[model samples]
Target: MISSTTMGLLVLLALSIPVGIVLFLLGFGIDAFFSPFPLIRGLGNLVWSTSNNATLIAIPFFVLLGEVLVRSGVAARTYAALDRWVSWLPGGLVHANVATATMFSATSGSSVATAATVATVAMPQAERLGYDPKLFSGAIAAGGTLGIMIPPSINLIVYGFLTQSSIPKLFLAGLLPGLGLALGFMVIVAIICLLRPDLGGERRMFPFVQMMRALLALVPIILLFTVIIGSIYKGWATPTEAASVGVFGALLIGAVFGTMNLSVLHESLLGTIKITSMIMLVVIGASFLNFTLASANLGGALEGLLDSMNLTPFGLILVVVGIYIVLGFFIETLSLMVVTIPIIVPLVVAQGYDPIWFGILMIVLIEMALITPPVGLNLYVVQGARKTGRMGDVMLGVIPFVLVMLGMVALLIAFPQIALYLPETID
Candidate 1:
């Protein structure tokens, strides 16, 4: 089953079958060859159960919220504002690339959107200013992965929904790790640029007065983040409920800033529909694949395989991280999470790992997936925004940040509290 499933996935994905369709097709093959109880008969019920989920409703709302922020110009303002504050660092606007991504991640829960948003704004500047394209574009791609790590993240919502964990607690778990990654990216850039000064552009400190004025541009996103995340953390709203609240807050922000309009709303809703539909297809397909796998006892087979290895807890985590990094090179992050969470999370929990901590750990790994070669969405996003650079440059650029992510995975291993502390205290 493992060999057949693996080959089928690789062949189908290589042939350009949509990731979601590949999942459904794989499930059908498994049902035909492995399951004795006619798992295919249950497909309709599984589809309904997965699609009807209230937690899933949050996906569209979050996408809509992000769309509104982008269309309303709030995202652009936030980017410009962060540039003023961080461009004085050793890497100059490379710091802004990461900073902008981090700030926008709080507003946009989709990593691709965050990367695309930042890349669109930052790419032209890299050319104009003569910054090293490798690190400059790489920072945007790597930093954009924060979209899944920060509060109000779509990935966390999906994780919570799939694992039956608390979405708000998951949000809390991600806060420190996400911010830490943002800071760590900046630190890595600073060290690199300090060692090789030509890689970075002019690092000029903006006047304090000008910095203060630029600060106002960030206020809208911060306020929107507070309303959405605060509502959930304070027990005033459920995660799904909070998503709607976030939409209202975003619309209000745009209206106050004079960026909201009939045209903006039309575009935002259209973009929201497109993104949400794509995510749901992968999610639903993964659901069916998971159902078929469980019905055929593949989960048990995988768990037994792990047990046979006699690995320690730390060893198991290391193995999982390794699996994600390799698979990330080929799989879309969302599809990877959905299909694996059902199969993998159970085994890890049986080994006594905290689900919440593992979720954050998985996210760190998923962030790597976004920047890694072949299927890395952020790599494509940043590359697409560029007019002339070789795609290899962006790929080469993300190497250091990938090492930094591997370091973060190690940190989470040595000290799990980076994810646990906020959640434990918040409740």
Candidate 2:
């Protein structure tokens, strides 16, 4: 049954069918060939249960927040502000891309939306400046993955909802690791540019007063982040409710900046609906597939396999991480999380490892998944923005970031405190 499912997934993906449709096809195949029961009969229930979720509602809300920022000119201004601060680095505008993404990741929840926003603003600058597209666009895609790592992250909320862990703890756990990766990204850029001076553009330092003035532009985002994350930690709102707070905060910021207009609002709404619908389709399909796979005793197979190995806890973790990296290349991020968390998290926790730490570890791999080829949403998004570059450029661009992500994963493995220390201290 497992073999059949694997073959079906590979074939469907190779045919270039839409991911959502491929998931549905796999569910049907599983029900037909793998299970004794009528798993297909559960499809409607799975779809309804998945879509009716308040937790899943965070998806649209977070995506809406990003749409508002992009439409209101906040994203561009944020990019410009970061440029004033970080363009003095060897990577020039690429540093701004990472810095701007780190800032926005504090507020936005979706990597695709973050990449779209940054790419829209930063892509034009890359072309005008004649920087290497591979490194430039790659930085945007990698930086955008921070959307899932930083606070107010929809992915963390989803993980919490799925695993029944505390959302605030997961948010806290991700903070250091996220920022560490961001700094690591910049360092990599600097080192690469230092080695080959032509890859990056000229580094321009802003005057002290101008840098101070540009700092004001960041106030709105900082306020929005505080409101959203603050509401969650303060117990003023649940994780899902915090998403609403973020949406409202983004709207208020847009109005304050005077970028709010009927036309902008209309575009925001339309773009929100399109992206929400696209994500929901895949999510709903994945939910149905998960249901079928569970009925087919796939979970039992995984449990048995793990038991048969008789490995140490650390060895078990390495195996789990290996599984995620392999599966990450083929699966969409949300679907990958949904399918594996139920099966893997329990085994890891049973080994006496921290769930919060493992969640952060999983996120690092998920971030890598965002930029990997043939299936990475971030790669597609950055490519979609290019309008001229081959898909290969975006793929090539993310290679360095992928290595950075692997280093992060290793760091988390060696020092779980990177993910746990803050959560441990937090009340």
Candidate 3:
């Protein structure tokens, strides 16, 4: 059953079928071939159950908030402002790409949104400044992965929903690791540029006064992040409520910055509808697929396979990491999470691992997947923004960042405190 299901998934995905449709097809296949029970009858309840949730409501709110911010021109200003602070580094404007993506990730929630916003703003600068296209574009693609690792993350929300864990706790757990990944990206870029100076564009230092002024542009973003994350930490709002607050805060910031107008609002709303619809469709389809898989005892089979290996906890973790890395190559990140969490989380928990820590670890892998080849959404996003570069340039550029992500995975496995510390402190 597992073998057949995997083959079906790869074939359908390779055929350019929508991920949601592929999931539905897989669910029907399982129901017909593997499940003795009539799992098809529960499709209505599964769809309703998946869609009717306050937690899931946070997804659209956060997405709209990102859309509003993107359309309002703040993102471009923020990118320029960040360039002033970080462009003096060995990698010049490349550092700014990572920095700006990290900043936006705090609020954008969606990795694709974060990547698109940063790529749109930063790509023009890469061309104008004669920066190396591979490293320059690669930085934006890798840095954008922070969106799902930072607070107010749509992926983290989905992880929490599917795992029945606390969304706020997951948010807290992700904070340090996400920031660490951003810092690691810069460090790696600096080291690489230091070795190959030509790859880095001209490093320019700003006057003290101008650098100070750039701080003003960043204030609104920082305050907006503070308001959303602060509310959740203070126990004043659920993740959903914090997301709505973020939307209002984004609009207010836009208005104050004189960037808000009806046109921007209309674009934000339309973009929100398109993105949210896509997410919900994939989510609902995954829910049905998970239901059918459960009915077919697929989870049990996987557990038995793992248990039969007689692996130690550390060995089990390595196996899980390997699984995600391989699957990450082909699966859309969210769909991967929804389909595997039910089966994987329980197995990891049985091995005495914390689900929250595993979630963070999983996110790091997902982040790597975002920059990985062929199907990596962020690579395509960055490449599309370039409008001229060979796709291979973006793919080759992300190689170093992918290695850094692997290092992050090892760190998390060896010392889970990297993920648990922040969450443990808050409560």
Candidate 4:
């Protein structure tokens, strides 16, 4: 069953099957070939159970919030505002790309959205300013991964809903590590650009007064993040409720900027429906597949296999990380989580790891996947934003940030508190 499932999955994916469809097909395969009972009969119940989840409602709300911000011109303004402060760093505008991505990630809850936003704003500047395309583009891609690691993250909501963990706690767990990763991105970029100054654009320090004025442009996003996360942390709202608050806040911000219109709202709703449907399909398919796996006792078989190996805890984590890195090469990030978390997370939890910490760890791996080659979504997004650069330049650019992510993985392993501190200390 294991061999067939793994092999069939790869074959289906290679044939260009949609990931959600591939999961459903795999589930049917498992039931037909492996299960003695008719597992297909249980499909209706499984779909209903997955679709009826109230916690899952956060997905659309967060996706809508990102859409509103993107459509209302908030992201471009935030990027330009941040450039004034961070462009004076060794990496110049490259630091702005990272800083803007980090800030936008806090508001957006989507790595793809954040990457796309920054790439659109920063790519033209890179060309006009004579910046090396690789690092400048790479910084936006890598920095954008913070969207899943920060509070109000759509991915964390999905993780919590699937794992039956606390979404608020997962949000808290990701805070320190998310900021740390952002800082690490900036430091790494600065070091590289300091050594090869030509790679960064011209370092221009804005006057303090002008920088302060640029600060005003960031208030909308900052307040939106605060409203979303603060309500949750203060025990006044659930994550889903906070997402609604965010949508309202986004609308108000749009009005303040005088960009709110029927068209933007229409676009936001349509985008929300499209993204939400895609996510829900994968989620529902994973649910059915998981149900079949449970019926077939794959968990017990997996445990037995692990016991036969007699692997230590750390060794097991290394194996899990290795699995994510390998899988990251081909699978989409959301699909990857929905497909594996049901199986892999349970195994990790059974080994005495905290589910919240592991969620953050998984997110780091997801972030790495976003910037890794072959199927790295951010690489393509950044490259598409550029009218002239070779795709290889974007690929080559992400190498250092990938190294920084590897270091982050090791740091999390060495000092798990980086992800755990806020969650444990707060509520």
Whole-model lDDT values for every prediction? 0.90, 0.87, 0.93, 0.89
Tell me the tens digit of each residue's lDDT in model 1 across 294-323.
Answer: 888988888888899999988998899889
- Candidate number achieving the greatest lDDT relative to the actual structure: 3
Per-candidate TM vs. native?
A: 0.98, 0.94, 0.99, 0.98
Model 3, runs deviating above 4 Å: none
For every candidate in turn, the CA RMSD to the true structure comes to: 1.0, 1.9, 0.8, 1.1
Q: Pick the candidate with the highest TM-score.
A: 3
- Number of clashing residue pairs, candidate 4: 0
Candidate 2 — what's its lDDT?
0.87
Instruction: Give the Cα error of residue 70 in candidate 3, in Å.
Output: 0.4
Sort every candidate by TM-score, greatest first.
Answer: 3, 1, 4, 2
Q: Which pairs clash (backbone N, Cα, C closer than 3 Å) in model 4?
A: none
For candidate 4, write residues 352-427 as lDDT tens digits: 9999999999999999999887878888988889978699998899999999899999999999988888888775
- What does candidate 4 score on TM? 0.98
Where is the poorest 10-residue window by lDDT in model 2? 1-10
* Candidate 2 segments whose C-alpha is farther than 4 A from its true place: none
